[model samples]
Target: MEDNDQRLQRIKKLETLRQLGVQPYGTRFEVKDRAGDLIRLHGRKSKETLEQERIECTLAGRIVALRRFGKAAFAVLQDGADRLQVYLKKDLLGEQTYRICEELDLGDWIGVTGRLFRTKTNEFTVEVRSLTFLSKALRPLPEKWHGLTDVETRYRQRYVDLIANPSVHEIFITRSRIIAAIRSFLIERGFLEVETPMMHPIPGGATAKPFVTHHNALGMDLYLRIAPELYLKRLIVGGFPRVFEINRNFRNEGISTIHNPEFTMLEFYVAFADYTDLMGLTEELFVRLGREVLGRTVIDYQGRQIDLTPPWRRWSYHQAILEVNKLDESVLRDRSSALAAAKQLGVEVDPNAPLAAVLNEMFEETVEPHLQQPTFITDYPIELSPLARRKDSDPTLTDRFELYIAGREIANAFSELNDPLDQRRRFEAQASQRVAGDEEAHLVDEDFLRALEYGMPPTAGEGIGIDRLVMLFTNQASIRDVVLFPQLKPEK
Candidate 1:
């Protein structure tokens, strides 16, 4: 039914109720107990024997269902956790109060003062003495079979979704628990939680397109941070031994089941640590979180069984590409060899792109989905990881690892680059790449270089995608499902 039509009808009903000396909207009703707690408290007793005790309650909620039988009636009232049946009789409530009960609609919120009892069918119920209208719900809730199913409407009217589908509330509850557990885990390990600026003049943390806005007061263009990597590292430069930030990070990118334009990220840095230490920490934290929050080391997502137990399998980028495509190590030396192999394997390659980028594309297309279990794909190509410290044995590869589960990247960590000269050169190369039309390229932040020159301690930092992690824990398929309000296209 149209909302306006229902509202008008309710207004007319209110006038009728007033004429009968009944208030259609009430102010307050003090409920002595919650539905669930009361049920648990009297669990052992039979409903009939319990109701005979003459228990009293001032319960209030929306009337979910109503059945009328001439002078008597039974209505189901839904409070927060559970629903209870309330019986209203003409003998107990006089004619005027009985009339109020008869005129009450299914969606109306009412407060009932009653003594608990049982019916002939032995269903525990409240024999209401008097009823008061708490609020009038003019619009009818959607039918159970066809509740608010449209994605756009569900996001736009999130309150309706939360009301109609209890599971959505559970998902968000679990999401909050996951974040809380992470904080507790870190704090127990002596890490201080911190916050960094969301707006930046030079977004040098990661290679991603940034959402730009003009700051009128500052009279400069400002960009939302895609990652808090640089600023957190500057903390290390200033001698904060351990710090972490769990906050929103905005990225101007394509929206998909796995990617959201704006989402929560947990990025933390630890001085005197490397990717190896961070990897161990990541494994420990995830396993602990899964067990503590979910009460299991294993969870099923879609059709795959994911085990979040620690000591996740680790593979180097070179080895991953070789194993997935059945190419030997000898064939992966340079651009020419990798390009020839790429063509032979039907994998797309960018001729002008760096060798590492091409290999990454191949791995993403061919190998990522096979990583259904918790796995750390380590030793990424140095070119693709400009800010990461290179491996001592292999200058071409960096000490970086991406944690993957259910074939999606969940966390990324690296031994941070601390050499000022080397960082300057990488930034210059990134600037050149930007000039050559890569909008996602990094910017050369002179301030970050100055911090590096000030001699920041050896540090390792990692970013965990909070939305994706929540999705995994909640068994939600789309990133939008976890996000309360995902961005959508403008309605035309």
Candidate 2:
């Protein structure tokens, strides 16, 4: 809701502009330079130097602040992430134009034709020679000193948040640069970027409840993708050896500081590579990103210093569970003992779950939080990973690894399962779970099985949550802070 007094004042101004035959909502205004660039180039120039040069420039921006001095005024014009002060004089504008200038309120967009000069306070200033009405802002901007402080309001009205908080703008800017850097790094390594369908016939990639929608013409249901794993692998089978995609995945799940229903992920696959190869590649990618984006291998994340240098700590699943819970190895290998251990740790697990599932539940509840630094947890149980290849030495465990940073899983990678018979068996097991009332179980994708039968190369694939990565790089604690518009409850 707008303040009544301010609304009336703005409305009166709008009427006045209309009476003057001026269109309050404006069109294009030619601009030669940004306010920031103008300052950067001539900020240090003396007033005498600027007056002698008589540099003329045209700029357009919203008026953020105004200081009136009867016949003269100084207004702050903000263009994107930069702000500049403009000096307007009644004598130069004459009576009619002066009145127009006087009636102009803060938050209005205007184009200024000006000459650059320095004020006595050593600040770079623009002396307005002429002004053009660009756009009228009815609602005033948020209070300058406090800005848009309410988190809910900030997320709800992100445009206002961008205007009020420069830091927020910078976060999104950094996010773009980070993504660009990732693309550059991958492309340099001979990886081709590709697009995959956001709607999947079967959610066969990961174990997560999906958002379902109907294609009325097709007379069937489609699910918003939970992961791009299955389709990316199909591309691999089609002979696109190295491929990557950066896109959104939707999950019907609980919201939290770290989780969003719709999120972005970077999924990539490379042929002739195993999980170990991917571990090295992951390390290289992180180090390169840290240096290129942050200019340092070490970053400060939520008050803790995280080192992104090579050779992050690696711990096997059993080792991590044993280290965190101090449980005997045999306890994790037996379903009954694992269930009892999970109960003792106050972790919830399905009574009918296998030992691997129970152990994983225990690890999530007890161990995941302690991984504050960059670390990799490897060699997950076969029951826990249906798509990862079985370990050569241990058939019960798969060649998979999850990268954790700041006590959160940042990336999951595995050696791709290429054996057609093995994939069929895995899919069958998953279908059984689906029939047994597990809503999040993967549905058997026959087309994907057909692709696997045609033979996919031994590949290494990984999915890194882009939102979580942005949160880490931006030092944001919540996923909402990095996401432009996160999901929220409906207002009454």
Candidate 3:
């Protein structure tokens, strides 16, 4: 009811301004300067210096705050980066312009031409010589909704959240810088950035259920890509020595603090390189990002300090599971024994799950939460990494590594499995599981297999979760905080 009253009052003001032939919703005002830049350039200047300089400028921003005192007034104009005090006097703006300014309210967009000056109180400010009413806010901003304390409102109405909180703006600014830094770093290293199709005939890149869409013209279903792996690898077969893509991936998965259904990934493939090579490259990229974005090699995430310094702890996957759970190696030998071990340790697992799946469950339950520092869990089981090359030392384990930090998986890398025959067999195994009620199973993409048959070189590929990486750098606890618009349930 109070909101409706405010709306009505603002509407009346709009009508009155129209009567006066003053354009309340205005056209362009030449904005040659911004509040933040003005402050940055001249905040320290003395009153005498500012008066002597007589710096005149045009500015525009939302009227975040207003204080009217009869014929004189003060307001805070919030531009993109910062806010500045604006003073309006009846004698200066004239009666008609002052009346027009009187109609203005909080959240209205206004433009002004002013000279930089120091207030009697010694604060730097803008003294308005003229005013241009750019826009009028019908409803006033909520007084209580000033920050991210109201989670649902903050996520749902991000515009208001951003307006109310300066810190929110900084996070996204840092996000942009991080992405730019990554792009610049990769380009400097001769990695060619490329684009791949988001829709796939068969989702085979990763073991995850996909969001299916239909092409009415073709009368066929296409899946939103779960990963860009196969398409990027196809570029490898096509002879691109180094390729990278920073793009979106969709997965039909549950949401959590760390998980989002639609997210960004930085996937790259390097020719003539193995998974071991990618480990060093991954560490270098992360450490560089830490220094560039956060200005430090060690960062505090959710109260725990994580070191992004090089030579991060590396442990084989089987070793991590055994050491973390204190379980005998026999439990990982077969499904039956693994299930028995999981039951005894109070770790839940499906009785029919494969041996490697059982081991993964144990690892997630025991090992993951303990990986607070940046660590690489390497040599994953062949069953778990269908697209990775088998280690020469052990046919059972693939040359794969998953980097974990702050108890969350940040990147996945592996040596490319170029043998079409091995890939087909793995796909067939996954297909059987899909038929047997596992929806998150890979489908045999014959086209991808055909591309591999054309001969891909010895290459290593990796995907770093950009959202999670941003979360770490910005110290955001939730993926939703990092994502501009996270997947959310329908608003009631």
In model 3, which runs have C-alpha deviations exceeding 4 angstroms? 334-336
Of the two candidates 1 and 3, the one with more favorable lDDT, higher being better, is: 3
| Model 1 agreement with the true structure over 278-308: per-residue lDDT tens digits | 9889988988888988999899898777988
Tens digits of per-residue lDDT, candidate 2, 1-492, equal 456778788999999988887789988889988988998888788888999999999999988889999999999998888899999998877777777787788789999998998877877899888888988888877765227789888888888888787679889988998899999999999999999999998886888999999999999999999999999999999999999999899999999999999999999999999999988999999898899899998989989999998799999989999888888887866888888888888999999877777888888989999999999999999998999999999998999999999999999999999998999999899899999998998788999999999989899999999999999999999999999999999855
Write down the TM-score of every candidate: 0.91, 0.96, 0.97
**Reference-based lDDT, each prediction:** 0.86, 0.90, 0.90
Q: Give the local distance difference test score of model 3.
A: 0.90
The runs of at least 3 residues in candidate 1 whose Cα sits more than 4 Å from the true structure, single-residue gaps closed, are: 1-4, 17-31, 52-55, 93-98, 113-117, 144-148
Measured by TM-score, how close is model 2 to the native structure?
0.96
Off by over 4 Å in 2: 144-146, 350-352
Clashing pairs in 2: none
Model 3 lDDT tens row, 127-151: 9999998888887887764444788
Backbone clash pairs for candidate 3 read none
